[model samples]
Target: MTGERGRGRVQAVAGVVLLAWVVLFAAFVEVGNPLVLLATAVSGGLVCACAVAGGVVTMRLTDAETAARLRHVFVVLEGTAMAIFYLFYGFAFSVEPVGRPGDFAVVVLLVLSVPALGALTLVLWRSYAVHKIVVDAFGPLVPDSGAGVPVQRIRVLGTVLVTVGLALAVSAMTVALVTPMYRPVLLTVGLFVTLSPVVLGVSLTRVTDVYSARRRNVGNYVIVLAASGFAVSEFASGAGVAGVLFGALVFGAVVLLVIAILVVREFTGEWDRPWREPRGRKVSP
Candidate 1:
């Protein structure tokens, strides 16, 4: 479709611009004593830009349901690429006893290639499963609109995954906080756990365009608060206990606030009415 092609073009241009920015920034920092923190921040910005571009491209090229399923894949790839690139650069330039070429190659391949492949596979599987669900559940209601029908199911599943992943990631962070110094096992597990929530959270946000805008806004607020608190906690003393506790409190408060808002909206007719439509109606998916 012409619309899809236009969106793809926009995404490609945005992605190119972001990649260029990242290269320029990295080069600028290379002249100075490159700090790991600076590298990470810059890399993170690039990753975010890439994620947005990927989402836009996916949304334009695929159906809404397919895009929802692919959201996690794109997020994971962007994050993994950013992390691997930043770490490689930092370790090579800053850390003493520079890693061997083979070792660096192996690490880069594992971090970038494996995760990219895994995410792509997972997206394909989820998409197929969502397609089947839509065909079975809403085929009669909207005979030709396969894409819209699967969107709701995708959203529900994505939200559930994100919530579960966040809980696990929090648990992992608790362990790391208790341990203080980074053990290889704990660090690796913590990183994976953290990434899980990130990937799933992005997917949830993408699917939310179909749902309650209020819920989406609340969720975004919670995510930002939680992320900022967690980042701040890393700099705290006392093994970051105080920071962790503060972050946890914030997260809990946000969760409670979101629930309250949802409850009030439900009772006050502020909630969207799509869920109330007849089961067989051709409501927005």
Candidate 2:
């Protein structure tokens, strides 16, 4: 289908579904425990807001490829949100339901979905904005096929690793959600699996001359530290060490803040300051 028609249909469908969800939520909000209902309502609202915002952005983009990618991303996100809500309601009201198992699931979905939307937006923007700049800035640094490894191979390897890792992570999450008792182990494995590909991809980008190796390494290290800290905090929380969990959480937050700055700087050309020097400046060896 044409991009325009596709996007219009997506927006219309999303609007109707979200509106129906809102109406149903309003009708039943008073029937359940107030706190549980409140959490579900808020999470559902956030999902709807993100879906709408993503659709709006998709509509505004002039690039057909980018718009299509955004459309698919938001569709998957909205569908996943709806599925989680359905599952939560079904189990919560079942005759032999356990004590609020779906509550944790809904909260986890919300926590994961918001940042996922943001990351999709950021990555899409980065791909479009930096494509030509990266080629011009680093094309000269690339060596001939006889002298060095091919950039295409590096990119392919990175893509393969990322796809495989994400598949594993998603599988882990699926199993974890269905079996709550194994959630801690499954989630921990998924976290590391998801991140390992990211680390490997960043490293591979260095060989492709897309970004400075030093800066890439720095960003990768910071993110790894943050992930480690967060993982440790989860373990601490399970161990009942409140202080350890609090300290690790704070450390991860600070590390993430630093990485966020680095990401902004990388995109803003701050990391390329030396590469973009005046014509007379000596080029890297």
Candidate 3:
């Protein structure tokens, strides 16, 4: 009993620490903070190791065998994937910190667009799923897996994001209505950021197992837009409009980060399996 309790504690701590990993990576890519990515990856690895060991030792039921195997893979993959993703973004910057948000935005725009231009590009690349980009570029470094995400989990996560987004939208709108402290451009940015998650959540509804790829693809794009993951120091350092924009950006990033975490855990758990199958059909391996 004591051993089991200890293992549960370890797993809980590991989960909390994993959130820090997502925040760092999101900030790293968004703001080009190299230090945040490195620190979180290294520390996340140590905690994940403890979590994996505890899980393997304590899994007692026969039906939980598959879960034990999956949990083990996901924990290790989470740590390793952190390092790979950090390095992937590292290629985007020089030794110097980014001087302007515009430049960073332009670079991201290009990266996101590259996967879509021309025929050959489309053939070599299948879907624009963010994981596909990482795996394709890194070359077999991370295996492409189904993630085997269930319908309910996806909907639940999306619902939570929508709820938070609406809350932020209301608060920001209230502040804007009360006073005209912010520039029109800044207010527009905040308003759009607030709505992005709500839109993304709705998109998830169209993805019921064997939905159209185009519909699901659009959902993925919305997820990326919600966070607009760029460096936030300049926008985040203000008291009025700046503060509102900063809060919106942080909320968006959290939404994106959490979704990524859920998908990756499922992706790494089930290797070489069909992602979503049509009803009344069995997918061939």
Best-fitting candidate, scored by TM-score: 3
User: Candidate 1's residue-wise lDDT over 1-285, tens digit each?
Assistant: 345445546555555554555455445432222343244435444443453455354545445455444544543444344333333333223311123321223333233333333333333333333334334434422232223535455455446556765665666566565755443444453444344445644544454233332234333433433343323333321234543453343334333333323322222222222344225643222
- Between 2 and 3, whose TM-score is larger? 3
lDDT of 3 by residue, 47-80 (tens): 3443343444333313233333334443344434
C-alpha local distance difference test of each model: 0.40, 0.42, 0.42
Please provide, for model 2 over 219-276, each residue's C-alpha lDDT reduced to its tens digit, 9 standing for 90 to 100.
4443444344434333333333333333333333333333333432333344344454
Error (Å) of candidate 1 at residue 271 is: 12
Each prediction's total of clashing residue pairs, residues at least 3 apart in sequence or on different chains, is: 0, 0, 6
TM-score of 2: 0.32
Candidate 3 residue pairs that clash: 30-229, 30-230, 30-231, 31-231, 147-266, 147-267
* Candidate 2, run of 10 with poorest lDDT: 89-98
Between candidates 1 and 3, name the one with more favorable TM-score. 3
Candidate 3 stretches with Cα past 4 Å from truth are 1-149, 175-182, 210-215, 222-227, 240-245, 264-285
Residue 107 lDDT, candidate 1, scale 0-100: 32
The ten-residue window of minimal lDDT in model 1 covers 95-104
